[model samples]
Target: MAYQPPVRDHLFLLRDVLEIDRYSNLPAFADASMDVVEQIITEAAKFTGEVLAPLNSVGDKHGCTWNPDFTVTPPPGFKEAYKQLCEGGWTGLGSDPAYGGQGLPHVVNLSFSEMSSSANMAFSMYPGLAHGAYSAIHTGGTDEQKQTYLPKMVTGEWTGTMNLTEPQCGTDLGMLRTKAVPQADGSYRITGQKIWISAGEHDMSDNIVHLVLARIEGAPAGVKGISLFIVPKFFPNADGSVGARNEGVKCVGLEEKMGIHGNATCVMQYEDAVGYLIGEENSGLKLMFVMMNEARLGVGLQGVAQGEAAYQAARDFAKDRLQGRSLTGPKNPDGPADPIIVHPDVRRMLLDSRAVIEGGRAFLFWTALHGDLMHQHPDEAVRQKAGDYMGLLTPVLKGYLTDKGFKACVDGMQVHGGSGFTEHFPASQYLRDCRIALIYEGTNGIQALDLVGRKLASSGGRAVMSWFAEIDAFVEANSADEKLKPFIEGLAGAKAQQQDATMWLMQNGLANPDNAGAASTDYMHLFGLTGLAYMWALMAKVSLAKIAAGDTDPFYENKLVVGRYYLERVLPETAAHLAKLKTGSATMMALPAEAF
Candidate 1:
C-alpha cells in the first residue's frame, strides 16, 4: 500500500486541539496562522507521498553500496529524493533565520518530520542527522564556525553525522579511545574509529560534517575529559567553498543491518583528521547532549511515525482483506467472507495501534510546544519551567514511544498473518526499521536510567511537581462534565499511580540505588502511560467541546471513541507497572552474573 500522510490528524491537532494561533505573541508563530499551517501540511503530505513513498520498497530491496574508494552510495532514487527534499527547503524548516532557514516553529517542523519519516524512514535519516548536527553547531559553535558551516548545512549542500560509538563502547562513553591531538594552527588532529555512525558517508551531498566526540591528549580519562570536534570530510577554505579532502576520514566499511538498508551505517576511520573544536574544552559531553536531546525527541517522533505508518497499512488491509465470517453474523452476505475488520480480535489490534499512535502524536506535539516555549518564551520563568518539563519528559518520550511503537508494528504485522512475515508486505519492513529506534539515541535502558536517576530529582523535583499540577488541574476542570468522566477518572488514576511510584523511588532509592535501577524501566513506562492518558483527556475535552458546538463530523466522533478506548484499555497498564516497580531490586538482583 502507498503511504498517506496524516494531514487531517495534523490539522486537527494544530488548529483545534493545540490552538497554535494563541501563541502569536511569539515571533516564530507571528505568521503561523491556521491557514498557513494547513498549507504547509498539505504541501508536506503531497511531497512525501508522491515523491518519497514509492522509494521505500526500492531502498529496502537494493540497500546501499560501499565502494572500494572508501565512499558509500545510497540506494537508487535516494539521492534524487534527497535533492528534492533540499530543494524544497525542508532541511532548515525550524533553523535560525540568521542562516538560510525558514525560521518556522519546531512543532511545525515536527509535523512534516512525521510525514517524511512515514513516507521513507531510511531516506528521512539523511536530513534528520543533518538537522541534529546543524542544531549542535547552531547551539555551541563559535560565530566564525557558524558563519562557515551553518549556511551550507542549512541550505542542504552539506550533510552531517554524529560520531560517538566505538568498537568497545556503546552506552559507556567513558571507555571511548578516540583521540584528538592539538595542533599549532588551532585545529586538532583526530585519530580513531567510530562505529554505527548513521549518515556517516554518502554521495548525496557536497560534504559531510562530522560532530565527533573524542578525548584530547592530557585531558581527563573519562567522559568529563571528552571534547566535541567538527571533523569535515572535505575541509572548506576561507571563502566557505569546499577545499581539499580531509585525508584522515574514511568510511572503512558499512554495517549490513536488519533494516533501513537505504541509509549507510558506516564504520568510520579517522587518521589524523583535521578537526575544529566546538564549545569549551573538556565540555564536549555537555555540548553533545544538546544535539543528543534533540535527536532523542526526533527518535521519539520516529517511533510514532512508524506506528502511524503501520497502523494505516493495517487499517486499510483489515477493511478489504477477506477472511472468516464475523463472530456474530455475516456482515458482507454477498461476499465469500466478511472483511476481517468485522472481528473483535482484529478490531482490537487496529484499535490498540490507533490508540498508541494517536495518543503518542498528541504527547509529542505537546512536548514540542514546551520545547518551543523553552527556547522562545519571553518570560524567563516560563522558559525555565518549560525546559524543566522537557528534561523530565524527554526520556519518557524516547523510551515509551519506541517500545510501544515497535509493538504496534508487530501488531500491524499480525493483522496480515502469513503475508506479513514475507518480504512482499510492508509490515515486515516497518517492523524491522522500527526495531532500531529502541536501541539508538541512547538505548531505551539508558533513557529509563536518565528518567529515574537524574530527571526525577532535577531542580529538586520542580519539573515532576509542575507536571503533576498540570494533570491535576485538567482533571479537576473536566471532572464535573459527565461526557468526560471516564477519561478524567482514568487519567486521574494513572497520574496518582505515577505520583505514588515517584514517592516510592525517592524513599527507597535514597537508601539503595539498586532499587532505583531495578524499577527504572517500569517507572518510565508508568510515567509514559500517565503522560498519554493526560494527552487523551485533553484531546477528549477538545473533542467534546467541538461536538457540543453542533459539529457532527465523524472525525471528532472517532477521536472521542479512540480517546475512550485508550483510557479504558491502555491507561490501566500503569497499575501493573506501578505494582512491579514497588517490588524493588530484591528478586531482580538475586541471580548471579554467571547464572544467566
Candidate 2:
C-alpha cells in the first residue's frame, strides 16, 4: 500500500483528544475550528499522497546529481513537485500572517508535516531546512532582514540553510575556523567552508538563504565570539526581485549519503561573500539555538513519520501475502494457507508498530500545542509553563522517539521477510532513511547529555519541576476513574521511578559528574517512557468519555486497546531504564583504553 496520510488519526487527536477548540480564545486557535482544520488536513492528504508518495522510490533510485556549473540536480520530478508544494502554501501553514503564511495554529500545520514526511522523507528535507532558517530570522532577524527574506521563504520562492558545520566542526563550534571580516559598507565578508549542508545547492528556488555563523576577525575565542549573518545566493533588487549572483559562493561537492538522496547535501565554499549581520554581535549561538530547537522537534517527527510509512507497507504485505497455516485452526479454510497477519508473531510486530506510531503522534501533537501556547497564551504564568515544557520535552521527543521509531522501521522490515532485504521493497528504503534521524541535529547521546546537563537545571529547575507538577495533577485528577485507573496507574508508576531517578541525580550527579554522564541516556529514555504513558492516559480518557456518551465508533475502542497495549507491554521497560540509570558511573568508566 502507498503511504496514505493518517488523516483519521490526526483528526481524532486534534479535535477529539486535544480539544483545541477549547482554546478558541487564543489568537492562533480563534480561526482553527475543527471544520477548517479538517479541510486543510484533507487537502494536504490529497497533495502528499498524489504528488509526493510516487517520488520516494524514484528519489532512492536516481538520487541527486552534482553538475559541473556548481549546481546540483535533484532526483526525477522533484523540481516540479516542489513548485506544486510552494504554490499550495503548505510550507508556511504554521507561520505568521504578517509574512504571508496561512497563520494557522502550529499543531494544525503539524498534520501536513507528518503526512508529507511519511509520504516522502527525502523530498521533505529541502523545505524542512528552509523552515528552520525562516524561524531563525523570524525570531532574531532585524525588521529589514525579515522584509527581505521572510515573504519569499514563507511562500517557498526561496529556500534556506544553516551553515555551522565545517571540516573540523559538527557539534563543537568553538574550534570552527570560519571568519567574517568587517567591510566599509557595513557588510561583512564571509570566508569559510561548510560541509554537510542540506538543500545547499538544489535547483528548486530563485535564491538560497544561507544563515552563516562565523567569528569576527580578532574576536574572542570559542563560541562567545560567534555571530549570525544573512548571505543570500543572489542579491535582491530594488523591487525585491532576484538580482545579480553574489559570485562569491559555490557548491564544491556533494555527500553521497546512505539515504535521503533526494536532498542535495552540499559542501559549500564561501570566499568573501557579502553578508548582513543579524541580532547583536557575538550572540549568534543564542539566536541559532532557537532554530536548532525547532529543527530538533521536526527531526523527532520525521522518525515517527518514517515508522508510519514502514508500518503501513508492512501491514499491507501481511494481509495479502499468504503463508503457513494458523497453528490453532484454519481461519482461511478454503485457501491452502493463511495470511501471515493471522499469526501471533506478525501481530506483535504490527501491533507494536501501531502502538508506537499512534502514541507517538499523540505525544508530538500534545507537545506542539504547548509550542502554540508558549507564545500566544494570555497569562504570563501559562506562557512560562508552556515555554518550560517546550524546552524540557524537546530532547526527550528527539531522543526517545527516534530510538523507538527506528526500531519500529526495522521491525517493519522483518515483517516483510526476505523481500525487505531487497531494494524493490519500500521497507528497505524506510529503514535506511530512518537511520539518519539518530545522528543529525545532534546525536541521541548528545540529546541525553543536554537533558541531564542543561535543561533539568534551567530556570532554577523550573522546566522539569513544571513537567512533574503537570503530570502529578493529571494522575490525581483521574485516579478515581475506574475505567482509566490502569492507565493512570501505569503513568503514576513510571513517573514515580522518574522522580526517584531525578532525586538520585540531584544527590549524586553534581558531586560525581560522571554519574550524570553515564546515567544520561537511560534517564532521558525513562523520561520518554513516562511522557508517552501520560499521552496514552490522556488519549484513553478522551476515548472512554466518547464511549460513555454512546459514540459507537470502533476507532475509540481500538484506541483503548492500543493504549492498554502501551501501558501493559511497552511501559514496563521504564523499570530497566530506571535501574540502569541509578547504577551511576563506577563500573561504566572502569574500562581502560585498549582494553578491548
Candidate 3:
C-alpha cells in the first residue's frame, strides 16, 4: 500500500480551527498565507512520501558504517535523501529571515518536521539536531556568531550537534569532567569526551557546529559552573566559508543501537579544541536547556510520528491481509477469512493507537502554540504566562506522550499479528525507534522530577493557575454542546482530581521532599493525561463545530469519536494516579535495601 499525506486534515487544523490566516496577516507571517502554507506542506509531503520513506527499511537494514579513518557513511540513499531535503529548503522553514530562513510559523515548520520523521526517523535526527543547534545560536549567540554561522546552517551548507553527555555523566551534570580553559584571546580551549552525540560526526554536510557544555577552570561545582561553546568541525572563515579543519575533535566509534541506525551515534573526543562562548560564563547548562527544550519536544514528536506511521502501516496491512472471522458475524462468506480489523481485540489495538496518536498530535500542536506565544507575544505578562504554561506542560508533552506513544507503536505492531515482530516488517523498527524517545533528551523520570520540583512552584504557581483557567474557560464556553458534554465534564473531574493531588504533593514536599520524588513519575503522567484530555475536548469541540457547519470531511467525525475514546478509556487513568498519589510515599520507601 502506498502512503498518502494527511494534508487535508493538516490544512483543516490550520485554516479552520487554528485560523492561521489571522497570524498570517501579521508582518512576520505576511507571506505565509493558507495557500502558501498549503503549497509548502504539499511539496514537503511529496518529498517525504516519495523520496525518504522508501529508504526507511533500507536504513534499518544497512545502518551507518564507521571506517577506521574516522569517517561514517549513512545507509544507502540516505545521503541523497538529505540532499533532497536541503535543496528543497525544508531545513530553513522557521529560521530567521534576516539570514536564509523562510521565517514561517513554528507550528507550520513542526508539521513538516513530523512528516519528515514519519517518513524516516533515523535520517531525520541529523538535521533535527542541527535545527536545535541553530536555535541555540540564533537565540543567544553574539552578532558576529549570528552573521557568520546562521546563513550556512540555515542554508543547509553546514550541520550542527549538541554535545552535553559524557562517559562519566549522563543526567547528573554535577559530576561532569569536561574542561574549558580560557585562552589569552577571547576564545577557549575545550577538552572533553562526549558520548552518544547524535549528528556528532557524519559526512552529511560540509561542517558540523557543536554546542558543547564544559566547565571553566576553577569554576564552582555542579551545573552552575557549566558554560556553552561553539565548536565547529571545520573552522569558519571571516567570509562565512569553510576553513581549515579544527584539530582535537574526533569520532572514535559509533554505538550499536537497536534502531535509527542510519544516523551515527558517535563517541566524540575533543582535546583542547578551540571554542567560543555562546552565552555568559557559568551558565552553560542554562544555555544548553534552550536547545534541550526544543530537542525534547522534537523527540516527543518523533514518538508521535513513529506511532502514526506504524499505525498507518498496520491498518493498511490488516485491511489487505485476510485473517480470522468476525465474532459478531461472517461478512466475507466466500473468503477463507475475514479482515483482521473485524475482530474486537484487533479493533481495540487500532483504536488505542489511533486515540493516542491523534491526541498526541493535537497536544504537540497546542504545546507548539504556547511556544510561539512565548516567543512572539509582545506583552511581557502574556509572554510570562505563556512561558509558565509551556514549562508546566513541557514535561507532560515530552514524557507522557512518548511513554504512551511507545506503547501505541507496540500495539500497532501487534496489529500485524506474528509478522509485526519479524524483521520482514517495520513494526519492530517502529518500537525500537520509539523506545529511545522515552530515554533520551532527559529520561521521563528526570522530566517528571523537574515537573514536580521546579515548575510546580515557579512564579508562585502562577503558571499552573493560568493553565487551569484555560481548561475552565473551555469547559464554560462549550457547556451547551451536548456531544462534548461528557468529555468536558469528565475532563473537568480529572482536572479537579489532579489539583487535589498536586496540592497534596506541594504541601507534603516542603516537609518530606521524598513525597514529591516518589509521586513525581505518576503525577507527571497523570497531569499529561489531564492535559491531553483537555486538548482532546478542545479538538472535539472544534471538530463538532466543523461538522455543524456542514464540513463534509469524515476526519472531523473521527476526531470526535477518538476524543470520546480518550475520555472513556485513556482519561480514566487519572483515577489510578490519584489513588497512588493519595497513598503517599510510605509504601514506596517501605522496601529497604535488604528486602531485595
Candidate 4:
C-alpha cells in the first residue's frame, strides 16, 4: 500500500488542539499564517505519499551495496528522492534565518518531518542528521563557523553527521577514547574510529560535515573532558568554497542492520583529521546535549509516524478483506464472508492501534510545543520552566512513545492477518524499521535511568510538581465537561499511581539504589501513558465540542471515537505498569547472581 500523510489530523492538532493561531500574531512567527501552514501540510502530504514512500520497501529489500572502492550506493531511486527532498527545501526547514534557513517554527518543521519519516525513515535520516548538525552549530559554534558552514547546510548543498559512538561505547560516553591534539594552525588533529554513524557516508550531497566528539590531550577523564570538533569530508577555505580533501575520514565498512537499509550506517575512521573546535575545549558533551535532546524528540516522532502509517494500512486492509462470518450472524447477507473489521477482536486490534496513533500524535506534538516554548518564550522563568519540563519529558518521549509506537505497528500488522507477516506486504518492514527506535538515541533502558535518577529529582522535585500542577489545572478546568469524565477519571487514577511510584522511589533510594533502577522502565512508561491520556482527553474535549457543534469532517468524529477507545483500552495498560512499579526491585532482582 502507498503511504498517505495524516495531513488533516496534523492541521487539526496545530490549529485547534494547540491553537497556533496565537503564534501567527507573535513577532517570531508573524510570517506563518494559518493559510500558509495549511498549504505546507498539503504539499508535504503529496511529496511523502507520492515520492518517498514508494522507495521504502524496495530500499529495505535491496538495501545498500558497498563497492570494493569503499564508496556506498543507496538503493535505486533513493538518490533521486533525496535530491527531490533537498530541492524542495525540506532539509533546512527549521534552521536559523541568518544561515539561509526559512526560520519556520520547530513544530512546523516537526510536522513535515513526521510525514517524510512516516513515508520513508531511512531515506529521511540524511536530512534528519543535517538538521541536528545545523542545530548544534547554531547553538554552540563561533560566529565564523556559523557564517561559513550554516548557509551551505541550510541550503542542503552539504549534509552533516554526528560521530560520538565507538565500538566500545555507544551509550556510555565516559568510556570514549577518541583524542584531539591542538594543531599549530589554530585547528586540532582528531583521531578516532566511530561506529554506527548514520549518514556517515552518502553521495546525496556535495559534502558531508561531521560533528565529532573527542578528548583533548591532558584533559580530565570522563564526559566532562569531551570536546566537539567539526571535521568535514573536505575542508572549506576562507572564500566559502570547498578546499583540499581531508585525508583521515574513511568509511571502513557499513553496519548490516535489520531496517532503514537505505541509510548507510558506516564504521568511520579518522586518523589525524583536521578539526575545528565547535565550542570551548572540554565543553563538547554539554553542547552535544542540545543536539541529542532535539534528536530524541525526532526519534519519538519517528515512532508515532510509523505507528500511524501502519494503522492506516491496517484499517484500509481490514475494511476490504473478507473473512469469517460475524458473531451477529450474516451481517453481509449478499456474500459468503464479512469484512474482517466486523469481528470484535479485529476491532480491538484496530482500535488499539488507532488509540495509540492518535493519542501518541497529540503527545508528540505537545512535546514539540514544549520545544518551541523552550526557545520562543520571552520571559526567563517561562523559558526555564518550559526547558525543565522538556528535560523531564525527553526520556518519556524517547522511551515510552517509541515503545508504544512499535507495539502499535505490530498490532497494525496483526490486523492484516497472515498477509502482515509476508514479504508481499509492507507491515514486516514497518515493524523492522520501528524496532531500531528502541535501541538508538539512548536505549529505552538508559532513558528510564535518566528519568528516575535525574529528571524526577530535577530542581529538587520542583519540575515534577510544576508539571503535575499543570495537569491538575487542566483536569480541574474540564471536570465539568460531561464527555470527558471517563478520560479525566483515568488520568486521576494514573496520576495517583505515578505519585505513589515517585514517592516509593524517593524513599527506597537510601536503603536500596537498585529499587529505582528496577522500577524505572515501568515507571517511565506509566508516566507517558498517563500523560498521553491527559493530552488525549484535552484533545477529545475540543473534538467533542466541535462534534456537538455539528462539525462536518469525518476526521473530527474519528478523533472523538479514537479518543474514547484510548481512554477505555490503551489507558488501562498503566495499571500493569503501576503493578510492576509497586513490585519494586524484589521480583526484578530476586534471582541469584549464579542463576544464569
Q: Pick by lDDT: which candidate is best?
A: 1
Per-model TM-score versus the true fold: 0.99, 0.99, 0.98, 0.98
- What are the lDDT figures for the candidates, one per model? 0.93, 0.92, 0.86, 0.86
Residue 525 lDDT, candidate 3, scale 0-100: 83
Q: Write the per-residue lDDT of candidate 1 for residues 390-454, one digit (tens) a residue.
A: 99999999999999999999999999989889998899999999999999999999999999999
Tell me how far the alpha carbon of residue 541 in candidate 2 is from the true structure, in angstroms, after superposition: 0.7
The weakest ten consecutive residues by lDDT in model 2 span: 351-360
For candidate 2, write residues 484-581 as lDDT tens digits: 99999999999899999999998899999999999999999899889889889999999999999999999999999988988878899899998899
lDDT (tens digit, per residue) of candidate 3 on 1-596? 64556677677667766777776544456788989999999998999899988998898899988889888888989888888889999889999899889888888898998888888898999989999999999888999999989899998889999998998899998888889999999999999899999988878798999999999999999988899999999999988888998897888899999888888999998999999999899988877888899998998898888888888888898887798788888868899999888888887788888888877887887778667777877678877887888788888888988888888888988888899889888888888988889999999999999999999899888888887888888888888878889888988998898888888987888788888898899899888888878878877878888888999889888888877888887888899998887777888899998998
RMSD of each: 0.8, 0.9, 1.4, 1.4
Candidate 4: segments with Cα more than 4 A from true spot = none
Backbone N/Cα/C clashes per model: 0, 0, 2, 0
In model 1, which residue pairs have backbone atoms overlapping below 3 Å?
none
Using lDDT as the measure, what is the rank order of every candidate, best first?
1, 2, 4, 3
Error of 4 at 177 (Å): 1.1
lDDT of 3 at 383: 76
Worst 10 residues of 1 by lDDT: 563-572
RMSD (Cα, Å) of candidate 4?
1.4
**Which of 1 and 4 is ahead in TM-score?**
1
